[model samples]
Target: MDVVVIGQIARDLAVRVDEVPGPGAAVAVRERIEVLGGKGANQAVALAQLGCRPALVGVVGDDRHADEVLARAVADGIDTRAVVRCPGTRTGLIIDVVDGGGRWRYLQDLPEAVLLTAADVAAAAPAFTTADAVVVQLQQPLPAVCAAADRGRRAGATVVLDGAPPDPGARSDLLARCDVLRADDSEAGLWADAEIGSALDALRVARELRARGPRMVVLGAGSEGNVVVWPDGEAVIPLGDADVVDTTGGGDAFTAGIVAALHEGPEAAARYGSAAAVLTVSHTGGRPNLSREEVAHRARP
Candidate 1:
């Protein structure tokens, strides 16, 4: 993959339970399903589906699940050489609960998931150096992610940052290093200090964020579509409606699609990205990422 992704790779244990649990209340549920997940892994898969070979850098436990993860990555055509095997830890796993209304909730206990060390980051630098773009998510330690982004920039690659799993304390220096910034509407509010209530508001918020560092900012509004704000101006990327299945990974798919479309042009990038995201929300988990042909078909006028 020409895109290098740095962050967490984990397994998700999802269940359909009753309403959200209160302080000390117990809720009963139905069934549970375990799937390979983690935002970084999801984005890498999404990027691969878009015809970009993605290289993922992260630490996974030397367990069966870890082996499966590595195998899956290779099978999906993602580079697996940079994945570190932490000898004693188990693979990171998240507990996700969905209610009758399809409201999703998460509880993460990443015992086996460890942030990449400086040495680990150094080992993966070469991959970023040769890639067209290095993609980053907040699943890894801030310092590690910063280092990777810096390395990618030094290597003359576009540093795309997706600042989700929102952190209130992210450093401005790192923000300054980003070239393309993507975030959800709520995250746009946290960065711009404005309520991104509508698509126009979200575009404004993205423009505001551009002043801080990134040359371009994209605000993902889920079913509302997306907005791209740059130094020149802003435009809303339209999307066709679909029966939403799972909201998870829609934004990641969007990020992946945009990165893939970077090889084309901005307009194509935005349209393909919107299509990928809309299609993602129509499926289950983060798998079944839309291929370039699928994205192209959806993006057609």
Candidate 2:
């Protein structure tokens, strides 16, 4: 399972409080966690935990935080040889503030220089060439995302796209090259140009997205869970029975799970994804902890 992940990498600081403060009032911080995180980093970490050899492709700064996060990526069993460190730029940072009821707020320090350029994606061509799957985060510049996807498709690898293309004009091109498309509620709404108010609505949008190009489509339907559609079947998938502790990292874990189990049918993949998301949201911050046996038992497909 050789995979290439193209997206953001950042230093994460997670603070947990029973409740958010208002005005200038102060409250006690129940816990603080600092780790390697970001959409790309979290997905790669989840893949590694699921026994895939993942190579991270994203930009960072030549700062101490970059070094620390890179070391952490290596320790988590991810290949960091393709990570770019831009000179004179500050490493990206994300502050995740989670409340007692599994809600989270984020403060991000991601700058333009920390984002990948098309040239950066081109430079990591070797990784794409050898990948069995290439997972792309669409929040990056369209040029970079297209470049990575094109490289993967040309190399005969499964190209999985995460999130909707921020550029409406670029959707067709990106979808045409993608094998799978996965998006959360807001992102799914972005694709549909309206809120997905129900599972049936999500299913309709998923089918439309699949018609555009993705062989499989997974769209979030708020609390109703995820809607999955493929060539031969479709279903409204629900989350596992794990109590939600913090919703952070759940989407990334879901994407990783699907990518990891996509060798099975799409239904099995959706169940695995749902199970992984359940496990991730049960903890804080955007890092994943997964177990195959646990996921298999928890999945409902």
Candidate 3:
């Protein structure tokens, strides 16, 4: 499938620590690595790895980091022709601190990414219109995200929104434009007006999010699996056990899987997403070790 991913592109600096330090305490870093990451880029790469041949539409700086990010995307087989180069700005950057438990905390510098404007979205109209699906992350400016979603919908493509808007008030309009909406526990809580730590909470969040406007809603609760709600019905798809090494891009990987299997029903697509996420978390970086064949094999009952 030809999918278009719109959002942030950044270089990720990752550090491994035994534990996260307290406010005043310092901790030893066990290891450090840098890789291509950002919600948008990660999902695009995941789609490419899954044999979707995705096109990326987002902004980056004129800096060398931008070159690295774009190079990696192209190497992974993503079409980067729609990636904008903004002068006088640095590419987005993210620092991920992973603890022994495989959980992570992120610090982001996204000045350039958030600067993506309606003009940028307008420039990518060809990509949006021709794509079978368009996946948008909330990392970009609200206007740009909305514009891209609107364009994709008008083009008769399936629009999948990857996260909720930072402002709760603007979420309804965004949801209404998207065919599918996927969110992690925290984002689900923001939209559902309830905490999302447990399975029940995830289901409630999915139901509430569905009520907002999306034709389908997917709420992912790490380890608890995913709750999928669509027009027909809802289902809780459980994921298999994984040896998690990092959790940084698991959500994005899940999003890619969903887009790849969208022709299937919501429950089946969520199962494919869960399988993709299991492979991602088992690796150290945002990139997954498995290919489309491997993911399909794992998804099989």
Candidate 4:
């Protein structure tokens, strides 16, 4: 299946720290590295790695970093033709701090990414029109995302939203435009009036979120598994056993997996997402070394 991913494309600087420093406390960095990351880029890469043709539509600066990011995406078999190069702006950057226990915190500067406008989405109409599904990461401008969703719907393609809408008031409208909505615990809490700690709580939130507009709602509850609520019914898909490494892009990977497997029912797609996430958290960086064969192998009992 062909998928179009629209969101931020960032150059990530990752550092290993003993711990997150307390207020004004100094902490030594154990290691430092750079990688291609961003919710949109990660999901696009994951989709390509899973044997799907993915076209990325986003903005980056006219700089060496932009060249590197696009180069990597192309090397990974992603179609970067829709990615725009904005002159006089620096590429988006993200600083990821990973602690000893594998927890991570992010500091991002997404100036150019957030500047993506409706015109940019319109320019990529061909990609959206031909896609089987359009995956939008809510990191970009809300208007741009909404525009892409409208185009996808008009083209009779599935509209998948990977994150929560920035404006709470627009939540219902955004959800209504999406065929599938995937949100983390925090985002789900914002949309639903519930604290998602247990599977039952997640199910409650998923049901509530589904009512907002999406035909299917998937709520990720870390190790507790994912709660999927569809018009027909609901189910809880458990995560697989894997050595935890870094969870920087686990959610994005899960979103990609689900989007790629959407031809199946929501329950089966959730299982595919669970398998993809299991492989993601076992590696470092937001874009891990993943393959469709490995994910399918891991999914098997």
Candidate 5:
């Protein structure tokens, strides 16, 4: 399948340490991994690994880091033909620090130039037109997100939205253009306007969201898992059992999984998403190491 992922593209540096050092203190970094990252790139990478031909549409700085990341994306079987490189802008960077407790802190250096603009989306029209599914990261500017969704809809593609709209004013219009919506914990709470402490609370909120526009709404309900609501039914799929090492890119992978397996139905989407989350959290960094073989093998009994 041809999938288009609209989001960020940047460098990622992940460090694993026993504990975060105190102010001015020193601690040995147990492991260090640097790879291609950003929510959009992560999802595109996961989609590519799941047997989809993914085209990534995002911005990067015209710097050495940009070259490295684009090269890596190409090596990973992602089409970077739509990736923009802005001159005089430094490439985005994210430093993920994980402690033994499984908590993570990120030092991010993403500037405005790394963000997508409406013109960029317009320029990538050909990519959107060829896509069977289009996944948009709502963290981008309102114009860009809206443009991407509208283009996908015009092309008769399955438009999936991740995160919340950039602005409340455009939320309704944007949501109306998408077929599926995936919201993380913070975004879900924002949609609920309150803490979603239980799966039922998430289901109620998801049901409300499903009415807004999207045919399916999935909300993260903290430790309980993900709640999915569709036109005919709803389901609360709990997190899978796994040794979680870090949760930096769990949601990204879950979104990819859902979009990848959506043809099977909502139940399959939820199961695949939960399985992808488990696999992602079992790793050390936000860069997902996913494959259709491993995911299906691990998800099944």
Candidate 6:
């Protein structure tokens, strides 16, 4: 009940292939599956599964997938009362391909996802205003993310931004509103205009982003784990060894972990958050549906 997620929601079609296509060469597929995805939805599901109550604010079309998405959100313990049903426009969609090595490529169609108007934001104002923290992603328009962050901050909630797709031209106002800024290595590298080849490089980028305003910067270092940088000091929480399945939602899970930890305190959250992410990699799909007890059991021992 303390966390609010605002942004686009889409259904993901994930396919696992034996090899990737190289310059006009097509490859054979080993297997395929579809699931609900999108950073907003994924993170919301992650929060709920991690034992944090999360409410989602977004727009979905009047389609079967939309129905399924909403139903799934409810089943996942996410509040969908703020979700809108836009007519005519199709529910957002994503086609993701994962190679044998876990490399991924995705093509998304998000027309209806952009339908979260200012009115939609107004409807969710109460949730944002009352929550302890607000979670947002870049899948939606920059303006919406900004407005949501501003509203949440004004309401006395900690605003957390998951800067995905690595938008370097991100709005400064939005950056200033964020309490925690989370992104992967590639995104960090893009923002810093330098390659994040190592933890030190990631730390440098985190520092650069922190200069913009966020109280904390978390650079997701893939298998190398994550680096949490603050004004006082920096902490590197290495990923525990886990078998790789699909890496799509691992970062979202990590974000959920960080938020949950923040619900406690920074130091406690970092260790638990690190465990949540590592456990996610050990599971399949984008969002791992594990309870807090399960996460703690795996994370601690």
Top candidate, metric lDDT: 2
Return the candidate ranking by TM-score, descending.
2, 5, 4, 3, 1, 6
For 1-301, candidate 5 gives per-residue lDDT tens digits of 9999999998999999999999999899999999999999999999988889999999999889999999999999999999999999999999999999999999999999999999999999889878899999988998899899899999999999999767877767877899999998789887667888888888888988889899999999888988889999888888889899999999999999999889878877877877888999998899888888778766553
RMSD of each: 2.8, 0.9, 2.2, 2.0, 1.1, 2.7
Off by over 4 Å in 6: 20-31, 112-115, 164-171
TM-score, structure 5 vs. true: 0.98
* Estimated TM-score for each candidate: 0.89, 0.98, 0.92, 0.93, 0.98, 0.88
For residue 99, what is the lDDT in candidate 4?
Answer: 92
TM-score of 3: 0.92
Using TM-score as the measure, name the better of candidate 4 and candidate 5: 5
Tens-digit per-residue lDDT, 146-188, candidate 4: 9999999998989999876778788888988999999888777
Off by over 4 Å in 5: none
Q: How many residue pairs clash in each candidate?
A: 3, 0, 0, 0, 0, 0
Lowest lDDT block of 10, candidate 6: 163-172
Q: Candidate 1, residue 112: CA error in Å? A: 7.2
User: Pairing residues by index, what is the TM-score of model 4?
Assistant: 0.93
For model 4, the superposed segments whose C-alpha errors exceed 4 Å read 20-31, 112-114
What TM-score does candidate 2 get on C-alpha atoms? 0.98
Better of 2 and 3 by lDDT: 2
Instruction: Identify the superior model by TM-score, candidate 2 or candidate 3.
Output: 2
Per-model lDDT: 0.78, 0.92, 0.85, 0.86, 0.91, 0.78
